[model samples]
Target: MHGVVQHSLIILAVLTSLGVIFGLVLAYANKKMAIEVNPLIHIVEDVLPKGQCGACGFAGCMAYAEAVVTNPDVPPNLCTPGKDPVAKLVGDLTGKAAAAVEPRIAQVKCAGTHTKAVKANEYHGVQDCVAANLLFGGPKSCKFGCLGLGTCVKACPFGAMTMSEDGLPIIDPDKCTGCAKCETVCPKKVIAMMPIGAHVRVNCNSHDKGAVAKKACSVSCIGCTLCVKECQYGAIKMDNNLAVVDAKVCMEKCDNPTCLAKCPTKAIRQAVLGIVPGNEETVA
Candidate 1:
């Protein structure tokens, strides 16, 4: 028994010694091979929103901070969630010329409410939009319309989206950070980023032909090309049986918007400027 105990102790001691030696070697190697991080990276990252929504085309805020500080090619204004104020701060820190960040907000392309849009079938499985969309392009008769499953609402890092009683998503422009998380997660591609300054916007995304689109949804764009013809600035265009508005051009040049009057189904509507969503009071 004494000899066996002695052998066990010897074996333990040998294993312990080997472990300590390997640990020391690893510690030394780690110290020697460690890459020095620039202090400016942390400083830049500190000013970021830190939502890590990947809106800036980087993996996270830390990666963006490193790129903006180390890479001259990376723009400081790439942080969409941070807006112009944060962009200015990053640009100042990096000593780069900061261009004015265009303020953007997520807009719902489809105006199809429960009453307006026809239902093809009722969903019985998961409540996720992506999952429902996979099953025969969702329950909506219009395949391009919002699934109304609240996937975008859940995905939003910022509290910008909400489901209306009408079975449509209402976007709060004030809360929207333009992260595009809602847009990215939407399987129907109903959500889109639009400039906050844009007043006139198309409320439909359906690509179905005039009669077919009307049958699916009352407000679907019918590709009449009337908006394009009405606008002297050439801002509106018909693409895949839908009317698209160039907000920049329309906001800049067009004063008398006859296109809003020209849309037969009223798919194109102007947002009542300064009116906050969910508020009954009109902004005077």
Candidate 2:
């Protein structure tokens, strides 16, 4: 019995010694391998929008903050969520000049909601927009139109986007960080990033000819070039039967939206300003 007791005590002592040795080794390794966090990281983080939207090509706001302070190549204006305010804060923190960043927001190029656009085929399986798009350019007859499966709405980390009852995604400009997540997720590439306050936008994405577009979606731009003729500012241009509005020129000279009224399909829409006609006071 005494021998067994001695053996047990010996085993306990050996285990205790091993535990102490491993503890010291761990402490030494931790001290040697400890990563030194940059002081600017916290400063940059405080200035961030805290949206963690990943619009800056980083995982989140914290990750972006680390990159900005640690990596010289990472631009201070990379955070789209924070926009100008965040950029200015980051620049002040890092002692670098904040680069000029144009204010932008997501715009759905296609106005072909379920009610506005006729479906080409009925989808039976997955409800994902990417999945639906894989089967012959989506269920819509217009190849370039939104799939309306809410892929973009799902992709947005912020609750900035919601799928309307019409099955088209609508963006709340107030909430949007201009992260371009929706733009990236859209398989049809129908989402565009445009200036936030710009008055005019081309609501159609179809590159098809006039007759073809007319047959596909009632609201699709038929490339009639009516907008080109109506614009006194040279803001409207015809490209592949689609009227593209140059926001900069339109803001400067095209105060009137004769283009909006003249568009047979109503493809051109005034941005956040909404459906106010030309020669009327714009609603705030």
Candidate 3:
């Protein structure tokens, strides 16, 4: 018993000594290897919206904060969710000129509703847009149209997105921080970021030919080029059998938009820039 006690004491002493030596080494290494992060990074980060949406091209708000503070080349206005006010604050703190961040909002490009769009099949799998898209571009006959699985609604960090009774996502421009979280998460790429002051929008994502698109969804852009020809400002263009509206051109050049009237399918829509139409129903 005495010998065992001595051996145990010796073992404990050796362990204690090893632990102390390791602790001292780690402490020294930590002090020497520590990279002093700028205190201003935290200050900048505090001004951020903390959406961590990665709209600024960084991984998260902290990464942006570090880049904005440490890198002179990085512009402080990269935080899309933070908008102009936060840009100004970050600029003031960093002594950098923040170019005016054009106020932007996310808009659902597809206007296909439950009644308007024909479903190819019924989906009973995982309730995710990305997952749904994997099984043959979702149930929607229009390959590029919104899947309407509430993935964008779930991904929205600002709570700007909501599902309509018509099976489409409605974006409240007021609540949207323009983080583009919904835009990034959407498998169909149906959500788009638009300038806040722009009124004209092409509410279709289907690039299928005119008859094919019409067959898939009643509101799909038929790519007739009527809107393009009608626009005196050259605002509308055709690409991939879809009408693309140049919002800036339409806003500045044409007061009375004739494209809205010319679109046979009524896919081109004009709305009050900041106001969302209907009670959670997207403008169709």
Candidate 4:
């Protein structure tokens, strides 16, 4: 019994000694290898929404926070998800005046749903927009129309986008951070960021002029310029067989709203749903 006790003590002592030695080594290594992160970076990071959408030009919230603390050129209002409250907090913390972030929403440019847009062929392979787009520019007869494969829905970090029953994406303005992730991921480039209160918008993305565009999608712009001629304010312009609404003039400067009623195809119309961040039922 005495011999057994002696052996047990020796074993315990050896283990204790090894543990102490390793602990000290780890502590020394940690002190030497530690990267000096700014304390202010963590503060700014805490205030941030941490969506990591990369709208601020930085990689993520942490990287953005670090840049805000270190770089004077980096603005505090860059975080779209964080919006005004976070901007104010960041500005107060960093001692820099933050500008108010302009409210924007993801507008799915293609009004062409399955019912409106004609289909060339049915895709049976992978259920991804990026993948489907590679297959003969997708199943849709209109090459520019949304694939309706939920690639934008997947790409959006914020729960802002949803695939409608019509096989088109419906964007929730309130939830959308305007990070442009959906816009970037869309294979068809049918999603565009529009200012919240912008009155007139051309929902069609098809470049096919008149007859061809109308055959592809019922509601295509067709570059008719009927709305342009009707507009008292010279806000509408034809570019690449697409009607582009000048946001500054139409939404902000223009008083007489005639374009909405004049659009023959009803392509350029008044935004019915909430254009800015507000509570609205996006699912139909």
Error of 3 at 8 (Å): 5.1
Query: In candidate 1, which residue pairs clash?
Result: none
Model 4 stretches with alpha carbons more than 4 Å out: 1-27, 274-284
| Candidate that beats the other on TM-score, 1 or 4, i.e. the better one | 1
State the lDDT of candidate 1 residue by residue for 204-235, as single tens digits: 88999999999999878998888888889999
Q: Would you list the rank order by TM-score, best first?
A: 3, 1, 4, 2
lDDT of 2 by residue, 19-135 (tens): 999999999999999998888798788878777667888988889888888887888898887778879888888777888778888888887877778888998869998999889
Question: What's the residue-level lDDT of 141 in candidate 2?
Answer: 92
| Candidate 4 TM-score versus the reference | 0.86
Tens digits of lDDT, candidate 4, 44-120: 99999877888898999999999999999998999988878889999999999999998887887778877888999
Q: What TM-score, computed on C-alpha atoms, does each candidate reach?
A: 0.91, 0.85, 0.91, 0.86
When summed lDDT is taken over every stretch of 10 residues in candidate 1, the lowest stretch is 275-284
Error of 2 at 146 (Å): 1.0
Q: Show where candidate 2 strays beyond 4 Å.
A: 1-24, 273-284
Tell me the whole-model lDDT of each prediction, alpha carbons only. 0.86, 0.82, 0.86, 0.83
Model 3 agreement with the true structure over 1-284: per-residue lDDT tens digits: 99999999999999999999999999999999999988999999999999889999999999999999989999989998888899999999999999988888888888788888899999999999999999998999999998888999998888888888788887787799888999888888888888887767888888999999999999889989998899888888899999898888877888888777788887888754333322222533
Error of 1 at 128 (Å): 1.4
Model 4 C-alpha RMSD vs. true structure (Å) is 4.9
Query: Which ten-residue region of model 4 has the weakest summed lDDT?
Result: 275-284
TM-score of candidate 2 against the unseen true structure: 0.85
